[model samples]
Target: MTGRDHDHVTRVMRTVSCDASAARSRLAASWQRSFAHHRLDPAAAPPQDRDTTRLAEQEEMLGRLLHVASPRLDELFSTIGQSGHGVFMTDARGLILRARQRAADEADFIRSGLVAGGDWSEEAQGTNGIGTCLAEKRPLIIHRDQHYLARNIAMSCIDAPVFDHEGTLIAALDVSSPRAESDGFNQLIGAMVSGIASKIEIDLFRDIHSDRQIVLVGDDRAGTALLAVDRDGLVVGATRSARIGCGLARQGALRPVPLRDVLGETSEGLSGAEKAALTRALARANGNVSAAARALGIGRATLYRRMKRLGISGAD
Candidate 1:
């Protein structure tokens, strides 16, 4: 190795060998994991290209998510592509499935193993952005030298985890730049990447639960506060944030709980609630009384009687 490369690896080893409590920062903790848990060598050569067949299989498994996340990936690239940034999306395993980079900067990213089919899992690449974010299940920025590997110290990586409708982590969105940048600039880019990831999650959730009533429960800055309610006003699904924040089921089939019960409401509000539910169902059905009635688990005649009692009109 070159003198500079050797020095970088030496520093990484020293940091990782320090006392556990002394390395309390996230970067330090990741370094510890890289050295102890993963047993990675910071000075090791870059990973080999994954086989085409394996990549195709991973792509097929994530086909639905790729379709939902394509536009958002384009949007993110448009925002940062010209600034020497490469946008990447990885499956839950940290295998990059798709990437968008300017033609001029493509070779550099490829050499650094930032292209599609590259495995950036924490176990594979140590304390890098895409892998570490997926490992921790949160948004993060691995700025330049924060990367455990000396070969990756020149690139800044920002990433965020993408969860599905049921709040299970499904993928990660990342933006990486080889150009030197200020910490403030990296923070701004990190937020943008995180926002795009959240948008992808929201789109995926809506696509999966299109037939249900989607309710925004709280601040959605993280885009996890979504609940899917059925026509009978039962919450059938919840996003990760909603599940944790609202105390709902975390896994498997969610128990059919009344929306009002989940929202901590009383029976005194039943009339108003029923009217609102009917209106929403009708709107979703495009004023088709039979369809809306079916969605609400009621007969067409019963729905018409309730609509009349509630003074709702505009139905055929």
Candidate 2:
């Protein structure tokens, strides 16, 4: 290794060993995990190329999510591609399934192990944008030396975790720049990545539960709070934000909780109560406006007006 490489490695080792306050900071804690749990050397060789068969399997596993994220990836790349940034999407295991980079910048990112099929899990690559975000299950920005590896210290990476319809973390969306940039710029890119990730989750949830009644549980501040309700008014699926905001289960299959139970009858005031009641009635009546109106002791026209006022649509 060169003198500068040795210096970088020395600093990383010292930080991991002597930094008692490392536990308090997310970056330091990740460095600690790299040193202690993963036992990764800051100056270790680049990660090995993944097997093609295994990568294909992972791609297949992420089929639906990949379909939903394709356009968003293109949209993100369109904004950042000319600025020396590369967009990458990795599966739950941190294997890059898809990547987008300008042809001129491709070699640099490839040399930096940012190509498709690269293993970037925290265990494999230390505290990187993709690995650490997946490890923590949250959005993050790892700029320059924030990366645990000396080789990766030149790039800035922003990442956000993508959860499946059941609120299980299924992938990570990332944008990386080899060119040096300010933290402010990195934060901006981070926000864009997070927004795209949320959009992908929302799209995937809707696609998977297309037949079910989708209910927006909270405002944008709640971060895509969406619940998929079945014909019987049972919540069959929820996005990650909805799961967290509504106190639904975070892992595995949801227990088919009632829409009313999840939303709470009085939590959102009269409007919420009315919306839920109309939704339940419509669901029970199989989207028949006349039948649902009769069940609710209201005329069809009145029910239609109420649905329109509540921003509900698609019922017969």
Candidate 3:
């Protein structure tokens, strides 16, 4: 390397090391781990492609993610293609499920094995857009020199997460393109990618909870988050937004909890939705209060008192 280029690399490395020590940013943590744990050399060209899943395995991976993502991929590709960006979808593990780019852009991606069946997890690629986004569980942009590998330093990547009906991070949607010195368009690209990811997540939620009442949750801070409330007014399922905005995230994946808890609303105020839920449960249980109460996710005694207040009459 020229003396000037070598000095710049040394400066960036020292800065990253200090950033890693301070733990001030997710990007720093990822870079530290890449260098410390994965033994990647930021100054060197990227390592060779890691082992990819076989064709048959790729089919299985596609089968799981495609239905939920298929309806929107074409439209997203059209938009991104028009803007000269290549888009890719990856499963939770960062295995590429699908990718699209203009013919010119497509060639290099394929040559680099950034195609379907490729694994781009953090451990494999070291601080890439798709890998780092998954590691952080939030959408982000990884631009140019931010990439751990020298080979990827010419590309900028934008990625967003996709959650299932239960609020599990099931997919990552990403866009990649050549980075210019002063493109000044990462935010616009991030917004577009985020919108597409949100649509895919909501589509999956609606399909999974077609029989339930889906309510919009966040507005003030979260913008638009969706949740499904049962007849008892208990939260049954939630979109990624609702989970984040309403603070309904469980320890693991999606778990149903009472709406009163999630919304912080008074029990009396929830009577309408709760009563309707009880009515449906009672009808389904053939007027059995015991079964209805159980279905309502409440104690029989609690259900009885609630029914009394609501003037709901049903046989025990």
Candidate 4:
């Protein structure tokens, strides 16, 4: 994290905390509706359209984050598996760029072409993660009945907003499934996606503050994280494992700390050369499989298969 990232975190924290406060007040005075049978009808409703001004704002922000993307998104999608859940990447304005789903669900969204050019607005598609997250600019988990559609009541969702160098929202990474209860894997996946967005923001910040020192703290309860820093000692980016391993607090800024000191005993736990090789692969390829495969002397598809065996996602 550079000074800019720190500032962004601080601002976002304040904004969110305030939003929570406001929501609490509103909730106290209003009826707390149960999600058990909640539904929203798109028909007999007011006309709704995407706000072009807002779309433009979000597009500019997204461009910054995408500029530093590792290009290994497809690999990450495969490592996590596209079954039993729906993973999607969207621009800030709620247009779907890419989506992954379970085989059965994939077929459903595929037909609608919602996996590609779909517009996922609460008004257009009814209340959903991709739309609601962009609308509210908040991290949220909408489970089962929380959906605005009666038909969608069987599904659950979790989403987080991605920001850029200027603290502007650029995109959202979200996951949806038919699970009744949120589980450990959901927590792990949500955390991983959030870290990726954070890394992109940090990377953008580094270019602006090339002389400042920053650190990124990550929570590593389940996966590996790839941390990157510039010559200025600022944390430019990190993989899922790094964030979780470090147990980074939400909205917290990481300061420069020696990797050895941060993962002293844990380092011993990860001594296998193969693990090291995979980690190297992720870094060398900027998290891209094709690049990593070329460098590692393996086929692209083989690299994906190997990553599965290694319990790693993306290039790692």
Every model's TM-score: 0.85, 0.84, 0.76, 0.47
Instruction: Kindly list the per-residue Cα lDDT of model 1 for residues 117-179, writing each as its tens digit.
Output: 899999999999999999899899998888998889889999999988777888999999899
Which regions of candidate 3 fall more than 4 Å away from where they truly are?
Answer: 1-12, 16-25, 44-64, 179-183, 220-224, 231-233, 251-255, 258-261, 268-316
Question: 165 in model 1: Cα distance from truth in Å?
Answer: 1.0
Relative to the unseen true structure, what is the C-alpha lDDT of residue 107 in candidate 1, on a scale of 0 to 100? 92
For candidate 3, lDDT tens digit of each residue in 1-316?
A: 5554455457447756684453776667788888787787766655455445453575574574577787687887887686667889988878888888888777777765578777777887778999989888899999877777656666788999987777778889998887363445888878888988988877887877888888887563433478787765677887766776777663245567877678886565567666767788889999999998887788999989988988899996
List, residue by residue over 1-316, the lDDT tens digit for candidate 2: 7777778788888888866858678888999999999999999986568656878998887888899899999999999899999999999888999999999999998898888889999899899999999999999999988889888888899999998888888999999988999888888898899999999999998999899988998675735899888866689998888888889888778988878789875467779778988987988899999899999999999999999999988456
Q: After superposition, how far is residue 14 of candidate 1 from its true place, in Å?
A: 1.2
* Local distance difference test scores for all models: 0.88, 0.88, 0.76, 0.56
Q: What does candidate 4 score on TM? A: 0.47
| Error of model 4, residue 61, in angstroms | 9.0
- TM-score of model 2 (CA atoms): 0.84
Residue pairs in steric clash, candidate 3? 231-277
